[model samples]
Target: MSSNRRIGIIDIGSNSIRLVIYEINSLQAYRVIGEFKQSARLSQRINSDNTLSREDIQSIVAILKQFQRICTANQVEEIRAAATAAIRNAANSQQIISELQEYSGIRVELLSGEDEARIGFLGMIHSLDIPDGILIDIGGGSTEVSLFRQRKLVRSVSFPFGAVNTTRRFSADGDFSEEKLLSIRQMVREAIGGERWITEHPGLPMIGLGGTIRSLCKINQKKHKYSLPLTHNYPMSAEDMAELMSWLPSLPAEKRKKVDGLSKDRFDIIVPGLTILDTLFKESGCSHYVISGAGLRDGLFQEAYLTDNSAIGMSMPERSARNMLALHSCSPMAHLEQVASSALTLFDALQQTHGYDARARQCLHIAALLYRIGVSMTYYQFSKHSFYMIAHSRLDGLTHRETVLCAAIASYKAKSRVQQLYAQFKDVLLETDIDVIVKLGSLLQLAIAMDSSETQVLPVRSAAVTLDKELDITVQTQNDPSIEYKEIAALNKDFKKIWGLKLTLLDASSFSTN
Candidate 1:
């Protein structure tokens, strides 16, 4: 019944609904703790006019209450529920927010189109390592385009031509024609400052987001496989997507559902969605995309966490926070600070012997900080916690495969947890990475042992590594004789086992700052 540091976000988008719980890993990656999605289609009603019907309001209330129950049951400390186009443009948004907050404890913030676009990319830029590009997110009521140069978000524009809106304007009654399609393109061009706007940002990559792109990914995933349809990190080359674009406009509405790879759920509006994608691709002159299931919901949760006091909990142990986030929408920040410090200390002590370059050391640092995150469940049974949190956190700055290695090393917090963790990742996680995780775990264990006092654990501030036969560590100290040799005996033994060399420790009485 211990508490966690989970933060929950309820995203009321145009096409679907979602609630996500996430936490930071030892690698500073925010993984998804838990998530639930509902396809409410709130956008369908509000697109034609700036108003919400009684049914649309009621549908929103019911979903908000359900999400509230989830937040309460999980003991979520933070909740940031935001509405996009539908609610923002609604004639009666004030009344809606008042009703939701009163009944469900879910306060609603109506986001302007530009702010909506910026919030959606929070997870995309920080966790996934997206390069400079135009981030185009097509929603139910509007499309948001943000421009970035060398990774900084520079200029952003939003258009009223979202999926549901465009369908109403151009694909009424599920029919497609060259003229209707041209109008859709014309609307998009005007909203984004004409066709020449594309030439301004020459070669920046186009990082597509939102439901329209993900649905397209599902279709391409099926078409690429040919036999069985499966969804999970199915990367689509721009060339592959361009080939499929040619055929969609010509296909009739009812016949669209009959086509292979089209999901029954999206048959009606996929053409409009694809039209938006096609125009953007042609104009951007960029190919290659990183498809993600994470969008506004993830970004909203991240922004809420930073704004809330929950960020204070980020310094707790990974095990404690992982356990908390497991039960709630929370995790401890202790692991981030502790493991980060320990890894830096160990890296400084053994850089030469460990053969670590700057990037390799940084990787180890991330893995170390995120290691104990898996142990957050049952403290004694922490390896599983490491595996799930690291792999599934949906953190920014990491690929799905890169996350497996982060989880792998975290499993080593408990001996033999590696094999169990590796069972799922051997095909994806590299052998060298597995070795590094084990090495990092062992080194971390040594560092923790050295700081037996825990109080005023000065940490190995500076050290030199020598390899004659055994690894020799010459460490300097800044404090008086409060530290004891007995406190560090076990650390040397663990050092020997992991390195296959004896550990020799020399402590200097006093040191001068160079």
Candidate 2:
């Protein structure tokens, strides 16, 4: 809520702990300022006993202390710490949590597997460009696969056997025996099978996450002289993966170092990561890994919204917006910005009178951001194109129904297209909420007319929306009543018919600014 400052998320994974500082900006954009990470491997010893050891506790304390200092120095308002895989698996995690709270003054929250996958998918999706693909987030202790069906996540599952876990069972400093490789492959195939990962969906493309895949992407990019591998959009084929896995361990550490894009931190686990991904592709018929720079960190930021609103949380709108943007075929950054500007102008003018809370405001914001996403396809009947795209978009933080509503709101601009274009979503929305969409759509229509130029804002003054007997919206402006009045009159006529209300206007003289 403060300017240039908001909160930080400290994500504790089995292998590492990280602190991220995010700023919620005026355009409703969240930006990262500081990111700090450390390798702790808290889940290292929890395999046999499913419990945290004394060493693990000490390590967590160290990470939390380090993170706290970074958060304090950065003036982070909220420090929400989330522990996954490691703490979730550990028997003594509570003891560790209490100790940290008492001695280190840090609070740690352990999340459910499903929630973790959802959030992790959020971060991963936000960090890259994969309009429609299953997100494969292979971590230290477990692998989370989330399906973005028709551009929306229909299912997600967390499987055991992560990079660190696999390294222990499959990887070796020297050449791993053929027998050892086979055994590891069998184990990975079995672990993945336990969740029926392959059986669920065939021919899915993957957007790979975690340090392992990132390191893999980095190495390949450098081999190709790709300075920025994450943004390069290199498609890693099954054959490419198999070749790399074979070559990874045979090379000594020095030889491995020679390979560009590979991080020193990821040396030990790279082989197993590739093996796991290779197996995933072999069985699931997955094509390639769309390299990702974002994963768990993005998930943690979305958690702030999730923790704040459950069932209907901060995620509902935020996720819906991001999903809409993802589904949009247009240049994601530019188009979403335009929609956000247009929607906010209308929302700000009516937020108070409508008692629009954060959730409603968030929905409006997302709808505005994704309004023209359909333009990415054919501009002809773009509104209809935009609707289906946003509805099925794989945006993090939003649920299915919210996504539909967002898509619907985006399509409200084209009248001949008929607002019935969103009849599909009517089944999912509340009657009251349907009315809200109507109001928002009405406002959008009015705003779009003012900005035929669509150049962000207009010089129109003091817009008032009142429902006295019938809904009455009056725009008091110091402009020629001729152009403004004529345009507004036409807008109000349609607004009254659709919303079942009579609309009115009162304007000041052009010479006298109101």
Best-performing candidate as measured by TM-score? 1
**Candidate 1 displacement at residue 31 in angstroms:** 9.5
lDDT of 1: 0.65
Residue 278 deviation, candidate 1, in Å? 3.8
State TM-scores per candidate: 0.68, 0.59
Specify the poorest-scoring 10-residue window by lDDT in model 2: 226-235
Instruction: Please give, for residues 232-312, the per-residue lDDT of candidate 1 as tens digits.
Output: 233567787777677776778888887676766567788788788778766777656666555677677666554434345
Single out the weakest 10-residue window by summed lDDT for candidate 1. 225-234
Q: Compare the candidates by lDDT and give the number of the best one.
A: 2
